[model samples]
Target: MKITEGYMPYLNYQTYYRIVGDITKPALVLLHGGPGSTHNYFELLDSLASDDYCIVMYDQLGCGNSYVEGHPELWTPETWVNELIALRKHLNLTKVHLLGQSWGGMLALDYILHYSPTGIESLILSSTLSSASLWASEQHRMIRFMSEVDQRAIEIAERTGNYESEDYIIANTHFMHAHCAGVYEIGKAPDCLTRPKKTGKEAYLYGWGPNEYTPTGSLAGFEVTD
Candidate 1:
């Protein structure tokens, strides 16, 4: 059970990465969600090292340990794809397995389709989307089933594009609890979910918009269903 962590150069910045388990073992590279989320959320996955795979996790360009500020241009999927390619080459991951969750899943899809690089052994997509528009629609549909107060709060926020309102935050919290972390009781999520440090808020807003159910950013038109 060996663990190592460090930074790798990406573009003009540094990307922080952590490795758990035997380095000689085949790499099980993880892709975390959030065009802005951190790899810290994958902390529990380190136990897989005992199962004989070297677990690799990293903070993408603008999130967590690898955070950078004021570069909204880097929030696009293309930048992340390129960063992943660089990471693979840097780590000499000749044989790799990918487990992508949510936005991370989308990044994996983009990496494979956009680059079609070799040496990828397997892909696991979890709770992800191939169509941003479809995801948004589904979220809205889910919202329709909530209490009228929740529904109206969300509706008013969406209509006014004012997500900062207290009512909207309350509504959004309800939606998150029901859909995002329904498995855990309120304020009782694991450290992964409750860890300190801000997720790349600027990037999240620029790449995926202000909330989970909306899409008014660069990824608003993103789709790979075809």
Candidate 2:
């Protein structure tokens, strides 16, 4: 399969994207989680790129291979929605299917609500929370499930508001690996995490928190249920 790459100029910066498989086929756009996450996490999506669909993946502004020079305010869902619209127009895609995971699903919802683009054929939301409150509730549950020692560490970190501490991060990663994907060993890991250029870290720091159930970043108060 041939892969083509390019940049789509947006208001604040350019979004980098790649197209795989046949462009003549129906388009399937993959939206990664992390309001700041790159398309790298969705490399497993390549499996769907064969003859049935044209796979489109891109690093949203401020992430991955995309331009990172911009104001933090530009990270809002409104800006990302515009980026998606620009990319769709640049590709000249008449209609396309969308698959979004976690924060990516929120972006998709924003796009559908604001633009209501005729080009949107379908939407797939995976492992996503409908609102920030729901996410916070889930985090509490996850923290409760942790071992007593780990739970105490998290409680201390939260009390001190030291979310960036190594202890917090370590506990958070363990929780994610156990509950998020249910994979114990690294060797048996999923393809997305095994990709050479994974965007999990950058996205987590900027958009999500150190854990799947926690929201410690700018998106902490973000709610999509409305």
Candidate 3:
């Protein structure tokens, strides 16, 4: 199918967006994860192009083609939600189906709760954490299944805030492989799992803290599920 791409201007920054399939069909707007994650990994959405769904994907202001980096203070969920509104208006999206993943889901929830905007057909939240506390608890629960070495590495990393260490990375990778989508017992990290994702450190550090188990960023507080 035909793919259309453009930069939508928002608050002195340009959000890079791409559309697959016909605009006449039901529009499905996909919001990516991370205060830092790019939209590249959502390639699976392309199939929806032929299924009568207008698949839209975009990298938020601080990532991918937009690359409006170095402004961590400005990376608030409100700012991102505003950008989403801008993009919707720019594209003249009257009726939309919003699908957000992880932090993207958090942003979507924030927008609905704050603005209560209409015209959304549905909201699909994938692998989202309702709150930082919930995320931490889940990570801790998952760690119990790991080996002693991996568990030690993860524990030490969390204790010392040394997520950058090689041991921490290895341990984190193993944990991610198991819980980040793996189905087998262990040692079955898929190619997609092994691949490195494009993430902005400034956005992550300012928005999500030093690591996954910790919550010391702008979004440190707030309860979504509770």
Candidate 4:
């Protein structure tokens, strides 16, 4: 399998992208989550690359190799949607299959609905939501199953807007282990999850608020459901 990588110019920023397998084959584009998460985590799917279709992954505007700062305003879904369009145009990806996870799933839905771009062969959404309110409600429901100590930590953190407290951090870690990524301990997770030297924390904060259970940012009431 051949691997190629480069930066695609999008507006004033350059999006770093990687392609595995033959570029001439149909494209299977992978979209990550966090609205700020990097594509590194999707490296696990690179094995899907073959002669049928190439695997395409890229870090969005403000994370990983495409890291940019001092632009919280650009953390909106529209910003990322336009960047996706730019990537497809830059790569001349006429036919594609999209696989989006979590926030990435939300982005994929937004793109398909807004532009209805042609040549979308298939779409696969994993662990995503169409309504922000529903997402928050579900998170709260999940939190209810946690220990009272963890619950108190989260409640206090939410009330004080102090997600940096030790208790809050511990509680959040517990939640992540139970729901997000619990297969391995802190440092034992795959390299893709830990290798990024920088992350789009600002973007995450601006777009998603303080933590997973809270919805205070631009996505506060975001809904695309009918």
Candidate 5:
């Protein structure tokens, strides 16, 4: 097994990436979630390397080691989509599998729909939704089941724009653990679990809003309406 790490230029920026396992074998590109998240959380997929597949993981520009400025304007899905294309080409991967989690999964779908890209052996889209409004709707359904106190707190926070309040964070964490797919026991969260909290906030807050339920951001109105 060989591990190679480097940066590839993309649209005036450098996208950082890592390749695990044998480059000659079938490859899997891993994309992390968040318009501003990193690839570190996907490290658990290193286990797939032992099975004879190349595992490629990268931090999109403005996140992790990509080193570009984390401007909200650069957080568009198209930018990340193009970055993935540049990464695949720079790595010289002709035929490969792709697995993207959450926002990464969304990127994967966008790439596929845009090009119906050939040489992609398969794709694994994990914990992602095809529609943003639908996501908000689903969020409503999910939150409806929480305790009445939490429900009222979330509503107050959203209405007051007080998302940082202790009541809001506590209620948000409760909702997140049940829905965010990566949270854990408070004292036992590994770096992967805590990383997105450290990455691009403007991107997350501006793109997806304060939380899953309140998508008052750029992506708030997005959906596959077509």
Candidate 6:
């Protein structure tokens, strides 16, 4: 039940991470979604901490509690892949299981396909879409399910390229809470919202757009399915 927090320097940035449970046990690394999301969403996985597994969670560069400086162009998939490798080596973990949700899964696959890390023992992809095209399709479907007024407003907003409109943001947030988390709860716990910030908000907006479903950022053209 021991928890430790630390930082690992990688390339031009540093990753903030937490290790929970017995270090002597099998290691399980959890990767959170959002090229910008913090590890706070996976707090539930801490329950898995025990003698059987050592859970490791981290905020990637430009997100959560990780180092947020240096180069913005370095936020590509390849950089993230190398960051994970660096963290593994820093922790001295020989072999371990990987669990990634959404973008995390994408990064995990990128690592597996490219670097072929020697210590990976298993992988778990949860609530993750394999490709940006598939995610876009799903998002369209979700938009269609929205109220007629909301749908029209969103359509017009996108058509006019007015993504910054208050109406568009409000409608988008509504759809996100309803269809994304599948949890309608309004307020997050004080501690939940009070967690340390990771990366610059601009990094996420520049990389993944305003939300997961809306792919209007640098990753808009990103897709992987074979």
lDDT against the true structure, per candidate, is 0.89, 0.75, 0.81, 0.89, 0.79, 0.78
Select the stronger candidate by lDDT from 1 and 2.
1
TM-score of each: 0.93, 0.83, 0.85, 0.93, 0.86, 0.87
User: Could you tally the backbone clashes for each prediction?
Assistant: 0, 0, 0, 0, 0, 3
How do the residues 38-123 of candidate 2 rate in per-residue lDDT, one tens digit apiece? 78767766777877779998988777777464265555566777888888888887879998887788888878876778878899
Predicted structure 6, TM vs. truth:
0.87
Model 2 Cα RMSD, 1 decimal: 2.9
Residues 141-210 of candidate 4 have per-residue lDDT tens digits of 9999999999999999998989999999999999998998766576877787677456888888888888
Model 6 stretches with alpha carbons more than 4 Å out: 67-71, 182-200
Off by over 4 Å in 1: 50-52, 183-190
lDDT of 5 by residue, 1-226 (tens): 6778888988887778888888777788898888678888787767778556789998877767874555667767777777877777888888889898887787888898876777999999898877888888889899999999899889999789988888878888899888775445876776665654347666777667877777786766666546
* Clash pairs, model 3 backbone: none
Cα shift from native, residue 196, model 2 (Å): 4.3
Q: Candidate 5 at residue 184, lDDT? A: 59
Deviating ranges (above 4 Å) for candidate 2: 50-52, 67-70, 181-203, 216-218
Span of 10 residues, lowest total lDDT, candidate 2: 197-206
Model 2 clash pairs? none
For candidate 5, list the clashing residue pairs, or say none: none
Question: Rank by lDDT, descending?
Answer: 1, 4, 3, 5, 6, 2
Candidate 5: lDDT of 129? 73
Name the lDDT value of residue 182 in candidate 5.
49
